[model samples]
Target: MYVAVKGGERAIDNAHAWLAEERRGAPDVVELSVEQIREQLAIAVNRVMAEGSLYDPDLAALAIKQARGDMIEAVFLMRAYRTTLPRFGTTFPVDTGQMRCVRRVSATFKDLPGGQILGPTFDYTHRLLDFKLAAEGDVTLAPEATEAAPEVPHVTEFLNSEGLIEEECRTDAEPPDLTREPLETPASRALRLQTLTRGDEGFLLSMAYSTQRGYGRNHAFVGELRIGVVSVEMDIPELGFSIAIGEIELTECETVNQFKGSKTEPPQFTRGYGLVFGQSERKSISMALVDRALRWKELGEDDSGAPAQDEEFVLYHADNVQATGFLEHIKLPHYVDFQSELELVRKLRREVAAKDEVT
Candidate 1:
C-alpha cells in the first residue's frame, strides 16, 4: 500500500473526518436512517443498485448515505464493496413472463393479455411539488384491488405468432460476465445486454435520444415495459431440484424496431431488449433503444456512422465507475507532474527569447 508523504496522511484523515461531520448535517435535524433511504428515496437506491450491479437495497442505501447522495460516488462505493463478496452459485434465468407485475404497459397495443397496469406510477402527476408533504410527510394509503391480478403474456408473443417479429430462442451457451471478464470487441448480445444493464443511465439515455432524433433512426415502438418481482431459483446439488432463493424486482423493456429483410430471408420486425434491477422505466427504455442502435450490423442494416452504432465507444465509456475514476484522478495530487511541465515551459520561453535577441 502507498503511504502519503509530507503531512498528507494527517490532511487526508482530517478531510475524511470533516466529510463525515458534513454528512451528518446539523445536529438539530434528525439523522436519516438507512431504512428511510431504502424506503423513501427508493428511486435513488434503485439507481445505485442497477449501476452498481448489486441487488441489495440496504447496501445501496448505505452507500448513498456514505456518499452524501452523490450518485456516482455511491455507485463507486457499491462496486468497490461488491468486489469483496465471495462467489456464490449462479441462479437460473428468471422467467419474466411469470412476473408478479406491479406496473405493465404496452405502447404497441391498446390492450394486451395482461391488460395495462399503471401501478404506483408518476406519469399522471403534475410537475408541481406538494407542500403538504414537506409539512405533514404523510399520504393516505392506496385502495386495494378487489380482483386478483391476471396472468400476462409477453407483447412480442403476439407479433411472433403472426410471423412478423423475429423469434428469440433459448440457448445453453454460457454468457460472458462483464464483471469477471475483460470486455472484448464484437461482443455477443448476452455480453452487450449485461453491459447495458449496468451501464450509466444518462449516457445510454443520451445515445438513445440521438437515435430518435435521426442519428441512426430505427423507428422503435415500445412493445412492452414491465416492472415486477420474479422468483430467483438455484439448483441444489444435494436436493436434486431447483428451489427459490429469493425475489428481485426488475424492469424489462422490449422494443420493436424497423424490420430487416434480405434476399434470402423474408422481412421480420427486429427487437431490442432491456432488463435492469428495480423499477427504472426510463433506464430500461433507453437501454432498449441503444441496444437496437448497436445491433445495426447484426440485424443486417447499414451503419449510418452514429455514435450509438459504435459498439466500442458505447461499451468502453458506458461504465460510470471507470469513467468517474479516470476523470477524478486528475483532481488528486499532481504537483510533481505540474512542476515538470512548468519548468519545461519556462525553459522553452527563455530559449525562444534568447534566439529572438540573437536574430
Candidate 2:
C-alpha cells in the first residue's frame, strides 16, 4: 500500500517551532543574551563576523545564539541578513597606511619603522586547561597611558622607496561585488581578495601550508599584520563630499614574496594582500599567503600545479555556506531515484534468466 504523505507545510512549521524551543532551552536556565555572547564568547563572535563579512558583533552574537553556537550557521544568517539590506552608498577604499593600529607586528625586519607590538596574542600561552576560569573570572587593572606614538607607515612603502617591492598603481576604478554577480573566470584581484576574506580559515591555512611544503613555495615573509578600527567614508553625490558613515574593525596582512624579474622588468619583491572584517589575524595572514601563491603567473613565477595556484578550485571551495548547502541538501528524499535503480536491476536479472532458459 502506497501511503502518499503530504504535510510539507505542517512539517516545516513543526520544525520551526521545535527549533525555537531548542534555541530558548529550559525557562529556568536563563536565555543566552546577545550582549552576553558578544562580550563573553568574543572569539566565536570574531569568527562569525569574519566569515559573515559583517562587522556588527551584536548581530553576529545574536546569530550565534539563534544557531545554537554553530559559527558557520551564524555566518549564514548574517550573510542572508546582509543580502536584504539596501545599498546606501559605497565607501572609498580604506587606506591601511593610515590605520590607527591596536596591534601591529612584522616578521620580516627586527627593527622596522614601527616597532612591533605583540599586543593581545595567545601564541605564547601554554595549551594547558585552566580550572580557575571555570570557577571564577579574574579582574585585572588597566595599564597606565603613555605618550602617543607617531603613525607608522606600511613596511612595503619603505621597500617601494628603494625599488625593491612591486609598485601598485593608484586607480580610481570601482571593484565588482561578488554577492551581486555570478563569479566568472579570470577574476580581478579585488574579487579574489573579497572571496578570500570570507573563505574558510582552515581551508585557506592548509592551502597556504601546502605552498610552504614546496607545492608552490614562494619564500614569503609577513611584512606586516595590523588590527584596528578604520573609518568608512562614502561620497555624497548631492553634497559633493565624502562623509564618515561608520567604523569597522579590520585585520590587514601584507606578505612580501620572492619574485624573479622577467626580461622587461627588474628583479623585485612582489606582494600579496589580505584584508578581512574584525580581529581575524590568522585568517588574514593565511589569506595573504594564499593570495601570493595564486599570483604565481602574474609575478612571472612558474605554476607548480598547487591547489592554491588554481583560482577556480580555491574560490569555488572557500565559502562554507555554499559548500555546506550543497552537501546537506542530499539529506532530502531521493527514494524515487533509488527505487527506479532497484527496479531496473531486477528487470535485467529476470530478462537474463529467461534468455538463458530459451537458449
Candidate 3:
C-alpha cells in the first residue's frame, strides 16, 4: 500500500501565490474593473445575483471579478458573504402587477392593452460576430426615441375572465427558506419556486428541455414575460405602516400550461410562475416550465417520472456549488480509502486462486 505524504503547507502556499499572479495576468495589461463587469457583463452579474439570492449589483460584480468569471464560484462568493450580514427585516411581497415594464410580450395574445414593448433584447439580432468592436474601444449610438408604454394587463387575466384558467391565489403564508433550514422532500409550492429561482440556470434549462422532448411535456406557452423595476416596501411596527425601501429590477414569467380536468371539475388552463432578478428571461421561462412539471400531483396529472417532476431530485441537485463541492471533492486525498479497497480486492483474488488450485 502507498503511504500518505506529509507537509503540503509550503506547496499549497506557493500554489496560491502563483494563482494570485495568474488571476492578475500580466503587469502591462489593463485589468478588468468591477464597474465594467457590473455594466458590460450585466447578464453575468444578474445570474450571480439570482443564484446568490442577493440583489446588490455592485457586490455581484465584485464576486464575479474575484471568481475570475466562474459564475457558480461567483454565486458561492456572494452567498457566503451574504451570511455575514444581519437581517434587518423582511419586505412585503412585491407586486409584479405594479411593475413599470421595459419588455412585455405575450405568446397567447396578438395585441394587449399595452403594445409589445421590445426593450433592449437580442432576440432578433443576427448572431454574426461584429468585428467593429475589436478596432473601436467604444462606439456611440444615436439616442433612442422614447414613447410612454401604456400599462400592460396580464394575459392570464383574459383567461380568468372566461373562467377557463385556474384561479390565482396569494396567501399570507410564510415561506420556508432552504438556506436557513434543511431541505425536506414533498416541498411546498413556495419552497419549490424559491429553489428554482436560485437554482443553477444551466441545470434548470436542461431539465426544462427534457420535458419539451416528451419526458414530461406540459405544453407550456409564455402567457406573459416581463422585466422591470418594482418598489419594495417594509412594514414599520412603530410607524404602523409600510414605507418604500427601494426598487429592484426583476424578470417575471407566467406560463400557461395544458388544460387539466376530471369528472368533478371542468377543464381549465394550469399556470406556472417564475420570478428572478434582472433581465433573465430564458431562466425565468425555463423555471416556469419546470415549475408546472413539478406540480403534476396537484393538477391531478399522472406522474411521468421525469427528473424535473421529481421534487427531491431537482431540489437536491439544482445547487451548483453544492453539486460541485461533492463532485470535485474526488480530487482530494483518498489514499486511506483507496488502500482499504485495494487490500480487499487483493484478498479476494488470493481466495479465488486457492479455490482454483483445489478444483
Candidate 4:
C-alpha cells in the first residue's frame, strides 16, 4: 500500500471536522440534552461512572453526551478528567446495611426481614419495542411509596449465625491501586475486587457465562441483590467528627456459592461480593460470579485454569481504553513494517522456486 508522504496535521484536522459534523447529525432533529441523558439514559451514565471510578453523575452524563453515547469512550473521558482533580480526604467505607434501598431482592429467602422489592425492574416487561416512544411522550408515572426502606438485613448475616457461610472480615489494610501501581499476580482479594468493580461489563458477563458452561463451574445463587443510595461520610481530623459528603447510588450483589470443605477446612458456602456505582445489577451480579470463580485457590480448591481465574489475564485485558488503544493502533501507518514482511516473503518464494528449478 502507498503511504502518504505529508499533510498528517491537515488530514487529522479535516477528519475531526467531519467527525464533529457527523456527531451532530441532522440539525433539524431536536438535540438531546445532558439532563435527558442523565435522567433517561441513566444506565449508560451508571456504567461510565462505575467503570471510570468516579461518582459524579452530572459529570458522567456530560461525558456520555460528549462521547455520543459510547460508554467506553465516556469512561475514557471520565478517567482522563478524574486525573486532573485533586484528591481530598478519603471517605469512610459506605454502610450498605443502612442504605435507603430503592430495590432489594433475595433468591435465598422469599420472606426476609425486609420483604422482596421488585422496584424499578424490567423483569416483568415484554421484550417488544414500542414505536410510539420514538418521539418523546409526556406520560407521567403514578406515585407510590414516599417512605424509604429503613435498613436491609444482609442475607449472609443469617447464614453466618449458623456458620453456613464465610465470615465478612473488616480490614484496615489499604488496597493497592492499580492505576497508581503495576498489577502483580496472585492479587489480594481486595485488589481483585477493585479491578472487577471497574471491569468491562461485557467481559465480566462472558467470564461468568463460561463458569456456567463448565469452564470453572461454581454453583452460585444470588443471595442478595440490592440497589440504592448510600451516604458517603469522611472523617474530618480538624473537626474531630465524621461528616456526610454526599449520597451516591450503588448496586451491590452478594452471590453464595456451594463449597465442599478442603482437607484443611470444614465445608461452608463461600460468598462473592460486587459493589458498583449506580443501578448496574447485571454487571454487579456478573462480577460476583466471576469473583467467586477466581477464589478457587484462596479457598484451598484446585485451580481449574479458567480464564476468569487467571488474575493476570482478567485484570490486564478488562480495561477497554488499554485494549482499544492497542486495537486501534493497527489502523495507523505500518508501511515500513509491512514492506519488510512483504520483501521477506517474496525473497523466500523466489529461493524456493530457484531451488525447485535447479532440482
TM-score of 2: 0.91
Tens digits of per-residue lDDT, candidate 3, 1-359, equal 11234557767778789977887889898998999899999999999999999999999999988888899999999999999999989998988888888889889987887878788789998999989888866767539854435456788999999998999867878889887887788899998998999999999999999999999978988999998888899999999999999999999999998775966557889899999999999899989999999988887788988888999999889989899889988888888899999999999999999999999
Q: On TM-score, who's better, 2 or 4?
A: 4
Candidate 4 per-residue lDDT, tens place, 86-140, comes to 9877888899999888889999988998888887889898999977687768756
Worst 10 residues of 1 by lDDT: 142-151
**CA lDDT, every prediction?**
0.91, 0.85, 0.89, 0.88
Worst 10 residues of 4 by lDDT: 1-10
Backbone clash pairs for candidate 4 read none
lDDT of 1 at 126: 98
lDDT winner, 2 or 3: 3
Candidate 2: where are CA atoms >4 Å away?
A: 1-4, 145-150, 349-359
**Ranking 3 against 4 by TM-score, winner:** 4
lDDT of 2 by residue, 1-359 (tens): 01244877777778899999988999898787899899988878988898887778999999999999988899999999999888876788887777777788888877887688776678788999988787867845449553323468888888888999988855677888987897776888888988999898888989889888988887899999988777788999999999988888778999998877886668889998888887788889899999998887776667788888999999999999999899988787778988999999999999999999999
Q: After superposition, how far is residue 212 of candidate 4 from its true place, in Å?
A: 1.2
Name the TM-score of candidate 4.
0.96
Question: Order of all candidates by lDDT, from best down to worst?
Answer: 1, 3, 4, 2
